[model samples]
Target: MSWIRSWKRLGLFALLGLVLSWAISCGSGTPPSTTGQQPSGKQEVEFWTMQLQPQFTDYFNQLIATFEKENPTLKVRWVDVPWADMERKILTAVSAKTAPDVVNLNPNFASQLAERNAWLNLDEKVTPEVRQLYLPNIWQANTLDGKSFGLPWYLTTRIAIYNTDLLKQAGVSKPPATYAELAQAAKQIKAKTGKYAFFVTFVPEDSGEVLESFVQMGVQLVNAEGKAAFNTPQGKAAFQYWVDLYKNGLLPKEALTEGHRYAIDLYQRGDTAILASGAEFLNTIATNAPTIAKVSASAPQITGETGKKNVAVMDLVIPKDTDVPDAALKFALFVTNDANQLSFAKAANVLPSTVKALQDSYFQTAPVNATPVEKARIVSAKQMQSAEVLIPAMKNMKQLQKSIYDNLQAAMLGQKTVDQAIADAAQEWDSRQ
Candidate 1:
């Protein structure tokens, strides 16, 4: 989930409960040298990203050069923002009418601002033919009330990273492909290895993996009126599923408080058998735990009956009040065009959101001698055909996450019954409305 972006930038996905943003907060690192504008008298299209600098410096430096060469009248000033500082800083900048012309943000982070009409309407600017360049499902993730606010950028889809040793110890030849199989495997792993099969933090403020699970299990989170729709039998079953796991001790105790980072640590240390994370994390695993990396393997992420998968996207948006809408829009499109996106994806080891870019042979094929990381990339890219943002962007997304997570935690802690928890969560969600 963090690029490791919420999943690689590792900031956004690691934070996906926080890394894998969708964990798309700002970071506190040094930016690329491609900063500071000159008095060249060219209209500057200021660009901001969530800590993509230092690492992608050369790629961006070349990107800016190409965009400037293409649009000679418009100069580009790239500013890389920290993960935690982006929201506050950008909010302040937007308030002061000094927001960047093209900014990087995810759906969840920008939904509230979208409700306030703080962003430009891409539907009015991006032509129908141009809009088709992106995956329709991914493009819809950036829309609210039928208006597009951002251009689809890079994406990360969770994959099942498993420790083969752990699974072999538990006598399982294949990783669990469904929740039923996962539950069974969880029990087996714990019984045999005395280690949890997986770690999913129950902290209401944690990643939305559990909430996304509810959807995968065929639980509708909202109705046509936006009221809670998760108090049904399916919701109760989903709640009980986790409660049973916690109570049965199939999950790590730290799950109640820890987050995605902890989950990754556990997996890397061989304490948890599986990690629902982005493929780019394989690189981190190879570096931080080389021994474990040798035995690590990837499977398609575990799913419920619906067979749905979660995707995190980092998009490029423009402020409605910017003086250079055309310039900003042109730069945004240029940066996200097929060729540019493929280059960035290769350099960064993430997936592209564009239909054409994703079709590139790099993402579509893997050599026979591909390492685990390379194979994981091929699997993740192939999965792009079916993956989507399970939890959509809405003004109340955080609240929804909080309500469900809080009630689920209560159930896990024995403070509430499964039915009571489901009903209360629905009630809490409705009360807020």
Candidate 2:
């Protein structure tokens, strides 16, 4: 279970080579510091963030300068890597023992490295007080085998963005609050307005969404022993729900193959009634479809038997072999503290992971001149109260997601029964163990 072994098995070796070439041709592109102060006996620590340069160059440069000033014995060199190159670059670096002291990563990639023990267990490095600063579920997302490996940084959660005018036209006064209601509204909206209610894409890119829906419906997914438990009656019912949606024309014909961008396009063009999306997309709507933005209203994303919603989080992790582990953890804490996180959030229009940052009146109170984008942020912040990672992080997560998605596609396209699909997916997951 070496870091390189699982990644190589997943066909990432060629990508790793490319990352090495790029790293050699162009060094990490470390930003120049404004201050010329050099500290004596300073341990040079590399800190990497995924594609956050140029836009936040000034902000990070200042932060790095301040951090260096404060920690006279530690020097942090900031590296901004492209998002597409992160996984390969990170694997290559860690394997070669040239990994950064602190690196920014999403939960899945961080979990993959954590599973192989490539990251330091932060539960030992950070105090309970520091851990308590973040939302419990978000903090829990970075834990594996009862040990925490990363600190929650920033997050985004899906909210149900729907055309209020369309709901009104269909005689529905409110957006759907639950999965059943979402499906019912879809049926009514289609029957009354003749526009599709929502697009249910089952392509590889959207498998996580499908998994989230199933979990929302009370599917256990993985059992207590970590084997697939989604073959149960509840799982079948969840699968059947989508099959029924497709069979009855509640979903678009391209649902089997399309991706989120296509779904967004449909919603923007008023071809769909509802679009489950992150708050950032509200700006896209306003820019691309002014008319639709005028009619768009958002609600906390729909839930099911359980009321939890899905969230995607970015976090900071310390490499297990870092020479300056203490300095790295301290610098990571400095960057993610309430003030810094809030500053970054305001700049990026993303949500902060720190509880105090989230509780700041800025998030609690909506802007006076609220546009759809502003409204989305206010609503999304509220939605964060119950948000958690939808697809539980696990080793071999990609395989598990694909297994469930492929079977779901077969069931949706009428190639297999719901029961058969669930059984086959469960079997595949079990075989992986």
Which structure among the candidates has the greatest TM-score?
Answer: 1
How does each model score on TM-score?
Answer: 0.92, 0.90
Relative to the true structure, how large is the alpha-carbon lDDT of every model? 0.82, 0.78
- Could you give the C-alpha RMSD of every candidate to the true structure, in order shown? 3.9, 5.9
Candidate 1: deviation at residue 79, Å? 0.7
lDDT of 1 by residue, 1-433 (tens): 4221234335334433224221233343233222224477688888888766566678888899988897788898877676667888778877777787889998877877998899999999999999999998899989988899999998888899999999999998899999999999998998898988888877666577888889899999998788999988898899999999999888887888887678878988888899888787888889889998999999998989998887888899999988888988989999999999899888777789999999988987888889998999888887878788888776587788889888888888899988888888899999998
The TM-score between candidate 2 and the true structure equals 0.90
Angstrom error of the Cα, residue 234, model 1: value is 1.4
What global local distance difference test value does model 2 have? 0.78
Task: Compose the digit string of candidate 2's lDDT tens values, residues 290-362.
Answer: 9998999888888898987877777899999888888888989999999999998887777899999999877
